[model samples]
Every structure is written in structure tokens, then in C-alpha cells.
Target: MNLTERLAAQPMSNPRADRVKDVAGLAGRSARSKRGLFLAEGPQNAREALARHLESPCVDAVYVTEDALGRHPDIAALLERVAGDRSVFVRLVTREVLAAMSDAVTPQGVVVVCPSLDVAAEEVLAAGPRLVAVLARVQDPGNAGTVLRAADAAGADAVVLTAGSVDVYNPKTVRSTAGSLFHLPVVVGADLPELLRAAREAGCGVLAADGHGDVDLDRLQDASAARAAGAEGVDAVYDLARPTVWLFGNEAQGLSAQEKALADHRVAVPVHGRAESLNVGTAATVCLYASARAQRRGADRP
Candidate 1:
């Protein structure tokens, strides 16, 4: 029942053990899907998973290294707080065993097994979210994760990954999120057209980020500012403060003409420098922040 006993009880020492292989198997989508579990590696992710566990008990177990415990006393304390839960499992392990269970060359010495983070598209849309980011067929894990984090930082109510997008549970994607994965609702494998239709029905104006669009990002900001400053009705060409969904696409291909056409408007993020374009994450960050700022400027209105 004490700390010492808990630490020694389930010592995971062998990298080749079947148990270790089972944990490492979670790195693959099929394995994760079959077992209904995935891995959250490193200290920050473990803490975030536990924080969510406190709310819903989705974390199945935690495996950690002794060195990691010494370096991160916070992880030690966190494990202690959750130790009493009969449903949760915590174990001490050799660094090699921890490494074997992770994709990282030098594992963070902590990994938590968690159920998939998917909430239904309905759950994300149920509240009629004011701001959202939609990733359409985005193939890169890092890009997806960064956009997720950016969306969270900009106070987006939800993020949706269309059917062909990278898995949010991909280890690289999870790492890039830097714990923002736990900060907001993320819906995966959604049908883009249906999702957009739902958003429209929920009073959301969909905007696609495109380079050749007629609407310029600077112009949109200017219009929002003018409206906030009590400008006449017609001067307000676009209302960024209103409920909106931002549509973003793959890093290489960008949004297709068909995809851009799904939105009520196609807005361009102007390129001032000679650079060709902004990557998906940067564009999403700028777009979401614009929405957040304008939405917060309600003081200038009623």
C-alpha cells in the first residue's frame, strides 16, 4: 500500500517481454484500434492524460522509469495522487523497458496507455461551437498536431480531422500537440461535406483558406475592425466575430477548388514577402486568432 511497495511490485525489467511488446504495439493504428488503447508518451503528455483521467478515468495505466521519476518529481507526485484508484495501474520499469515501449529513440521515461480521444462529430457540434478548425485530408502528423495546438491556443471550441487526415493519436502528432491535445475536443474521421452541412445548419459560416481567393485576410480584419468601430452596415463585408469554421487542407496540395467551394467564402492570407505561402498551421493560427480577437471586441458593440 506504501510508495516503496507500489514501486517494486510491478517492476518491468525486460524489453523483450511479451507485455512490453504489447504496449509498444500501440504505436500502430491497427493495434491501437483492436485494443481500443493508445500511448501518450513523455512527462507532459502523461500529466495531461492524468488530468483528463481525473475527469473521466480514460487512462488505463502508466509505465515509468526510475531516472525519470528522479528528474520529474511532478510525475512521481502525479502517480501518487492516482495510485489509490483501483481501475488505474502504475508500474516502475527499467529505462530500456520504457524505451522498448516507445517510438522515441530516447524515450521520455514515461508513457501512459489511454483510450482513443475521439469524441463524435455530434459531440463537437452539439454546443454550436463559435470557432472551429477543419483539417481536410491533411497527411502530415506534425502539421496536424501543430494546427490542433494552435486551434486550442486561439480558443477554438473544437477541431475536426476529415477522413483522410493524419491520425491525431499518431505518436508524432501527439508529441507535437504538447499537451494541447487534452485542452479541447477533437473529432476524427469526419465526412467533410456532412460536417460542413451540420456547421451551416448550426449557424456557422464556413471560410476556406486559399491563396487565390477574392477575400483577403487583411481586408477581412479591416472590415471586422471597422464594424467594431461603429462603421456603417455596408462597410462590414465580413464578420469574423460571428460563428465560423475555418477549412484547412494538406501541406503540399492545399485545398482543392472543390474544397474551397464548400465554404461560404474563400479567404486568402496575403503573402507580403516573397515566400510562396504560409503552411497550414501558421495560417490556421492566424485565422483562429483573428476570430478570437474580433469575438472579444464585443465591447465596441452592444
Candidate 2:
């Protein structure tokens, strides 16, 4: 019940102990992909997970070292409150072992293992007239996380990543989110066509970003009919509050011709500076925020 008892009670070993040989081993898609689980490392993410546990209990385990205990005594109180919950597991490790299991130069002395959500197309579709980001094979971990974080900050309902997008649960991605991951629903391993179909069915418009698109993002903001919705039957209105998926493609190739064809509108972010183009993540942020602002404007309209 007390802080001292809680700290002393953290399990040091289990009846059936499983030793993780290397932190890098858990980085692969196969292990994480198969288990539908991922690791969140560092003080920030671990602390965020603890905060979530305090709020509604979203994580499975809190693994830490003595150094972490020394630094963050508050976590002991958090662990004590929810430790009896079936999903909550707490463990303490040696500093050397913690260092081996950490990816950072300076390990924050704590990490969390949590369930990776297998978001359904139906759920995404059900969020009608919602703002969503569809990441198509975004490779960079930081970029992918930034996009998700931005989407959440902009009030996008959810983010659906195509089959090839970077792992949303990567340590760097989790860190970059800065706890926005907890604030939004992120669907990974979604099929592009199925997602597109859901968007259409839900009366959501798909806006694919392309450097060559005839329509500019500003036009969409103004609610102007610069580009007509395609024959796919998606909504012509680029209403962010309505179901909308802002499609962002790979960093190197951009959106494929077929992918662009599926979009109800293809809009480009106008750039005046010498930069060739915006990064996929940056471009996504600009587009998502614009939709968020426009959606707010629409809400305020009448």
C-alpha cells in the first residue's frame, strides 16, 4: 500500500522467466508483426504509458532498471495503483541489461510492452466525415511518427497506414509522437483499395497529394470546385469533418499514378521557395492542418 512496499514489490523474476537476448531482436517486423505487440522505450514514452494507465490502462508491462527507480520514484506510486489489474505487469532489471535492451545512447532506464491495435476498415469507415491520414509505404520512422502526431494535433480522427508504411510502434516513432499516439487511433496494415472503398462508402473524400496535381491545397480550403470528384463516387466536398483521408505516399517515389487516380482530388502544396518539394511528413502536416482549420471554419459557419 505504501511507496516503499510498492518499490520493493516490483517483481524481479518470474516462475517462467523469458530472457530477451537483444533489444535489436524485437525491432524486426516479424516478431512484432506476429505478436501484435510493440515496445515503447525511454522516459517520455514509458511515462506516457504510465499516464495512460492512470487514465484508462492501455499498456501491458512496465519494465525498468534500478537507475530509473532512483530517478523516477513517482512511477512506483503509479505502478502500485494499477499493478493488480490483469493487463498491468511490472518488472525491474539490472542497469547493464537495461542498457543492452535499449536503442538509445543514453537509455532512459524504462520501457513498455503494449498491444498493437489491429484497426478495422469498418471502424475507420464508421467514423464518417472524419479526418484520416493514409500513409502509403512511408519509410522513415521519424517521418511516420511526425505525421501521426501532426494528425492527432490537427484533430484528425484516425490514421490508417498502408501495408508498406513504417512500423508505428517503433521506439523512435513512439518518442516522436510525444504521447499523441495515445490520443488517436492508428490503423496499420490496411489495404489501399479497401480503405479507399471504405472512405467512399462513408461519404469521405480522398485527397492524394501530388506535385503534378492540377488543384492546389488552398483551393480545397476555400471550398472551391477546382477539381471534380472522380468517377469512383467519392464525395466532391473536401469536408474535413466528413470522412476524409489525406493520402501521403512514399518519400522517394511519391504517389503512384494508379493511387493518384483513386483520389477524389489531387492537390499540390504550392511552394515558392527553392525547395524542390516538401517532405512527405511535412506535406502531410500542412494538408492535415489545413483540413482541420477548414473543418473548424465549417463548424463555425452556421
lDDT of each: 0.88, 0.75
Residue-by-residue lDDT tens digits, candidate 1, 106-148:
6898988888888998887889899999999999989999999
Candidate 1's TM-score reads 0.96
**Which candidate ranks first by lDDT, i.e. highest?**
1
Poorly placed runs, candidate 1 (over 4 Å): 1-4
How many clashes in each structure?
0, 5
Residue 41 of model 1 has an lDDT of 90
What TM-score would candidate 2 get against the native? Answer: 0.85
Q: 219-270 in candidate 2: lDDT tens per residue?
A: 5665522222212333434554445688999999999998899898888998
TM-score of each: 0.96, 0.85
Summing lDDT over every window of 10 consecutive residues in candidate 1, give the lowest-scoring window: 229-238
